[model samples]
Target: MTALPLTEAARGATPTSSRVAAVTRLHLARRINVLVVPLIITAVVFVVTIVIQVAIQRATAGGSTAADYAAGARLNPAIAWAQTGYFVALGVSTVASTFPLAASLGTTRRDFALGTTLAHLLTSLYLTAVFTALLGLELLTDHWFGGFYVFDVGLLGAGDPATFAATIAVSSLLCLSIGSVFGAAWLRFGPRGPLAISLATVLVLAVVLLVAVPSFDALTTAFRPWWLVVGAAALIVLSVGGTFAFLRRASVR
Candidate 1:
């Protein structure tokens, strides 16, 4: 007897289900380039910075008194941590760059936006893990580097661990929110989009800085306690909301 044609079963395959699977695969594939590579680069940068800062601290306090070493070492992590904004920017931009690729691949706008946002969230988690590991190492090694706000073995019993934990928790959320919006915008709108957003952010920040600094003549600081948190929250909310709105407004394939 003649065998049934394979084409008949193939023709009966569900298109919608296949399309969803295809979209998922495509999202994952795009994510590797947009998220993983950038996160790796950020991690590498963090390692290099840590090494350099540690070396600098060692050189400065290689033969100094314990108190002197502690003081000197403490400054390095603080400085290095400040410079971490560069890695954050890189991670965000990497995720953002994926938008154009998604669009090029004929993925729906919503999927593209959501993918970009998810990539940022993943990268933020990665960074948070790295920071935590670094902090733990510092504490374990009795490294008295003040810049990073690490636990001092001697002070571990005396100091407030809750503060450190809370700080990390807050910082991680801030990074994720900021990175998500920045990266998504870059991906969706190319270089111009990032430029516009960056410029606007800078302008607003500059104004705040100028306004706040000059007003500190009364024993008060202009740095709002919740400024970073609130700003991050706004960015995250706007990014998600705007992305969805944009997708809805646009005609997707």
Candidate 2:
């Protein structure tokens, strides 16, 4: 039998195009998993913590259990934002290290890098806002599901608003800057890059912790919202600018 002519080949291209579309959709679906998995894990952990704290409160009287004392006050809503920021920063870093799922997507490595970085920013903002709203709702209204401990520990309380906001801002900034650089390195070198970044982040954090912990009692007095806002802004500028630079270079190759 004779092979199909050019006309037949053109006709057959429709299936190939359709398949490509299907595959692209699949890739997008998988990409979403990167964000979803982290969210689910964080949610589960948060819920468990709340449950455990509530149970302990009931078991020990109005005060709290030994475990609660060891763990410090219950999860502060503001700190939750800080934690979210940190995780987004980390996730962006990690995703940057990995190659885009398919070469066929024709999305340049730079776009992939930018996309993941933006995803981090957006997800963190969404989560932080969600947490803040939840806390606000609890405070404004009398009816809530949990016990008294949730009221005492969950809310930011009076003096906590400014301080906690500062913490969230500072943490987000620091994480974003560090994560971006680490992510760039990871993209450049692959597996070994993350290990290197991890060690570096830990070392840097350790040094800061050593200094901060010692002086915290005194430093707390001087800490201000303006300082945190300024610091966070600086770090954000640096991180975003640096990442874009890295991506520009990456695109060249």
Over 6-115, each residue of candidate 2 has an lDDT whose tens digit, in order, gives 34454355454343443334323454444465456556655766677567656667565555653454444533553555565564544463333422344344444455
Where does candidate 1 stray beyond 4 Å?
1-64, 78-96, 100-107, 144-191, 218-227, 239-253
Q: What's the lDDT for candidate 1?
A: 0.51
Residue-wise C-alpha lDDT for candidate 1, range 166-209, written one tens digit per residue? 44444554554565555655545656766887799799999988
Q: After superposition, how far is residue 5 of candidate 1 from its true place, in Å?
A: 26
lDDT of 1 at 81: 51
- Model 1, residue 187: displacement in angstroms? 5.9
lDDT at position 41, candidate 2: 54
| lDDT (Cα atoms) of all candidates against the true structure | 0.51, 0.51
Off by over 4 Å in 2: 1-35, 62-94, 97-104, 108-114, 140-143, 148-180, 195-218, 245-253
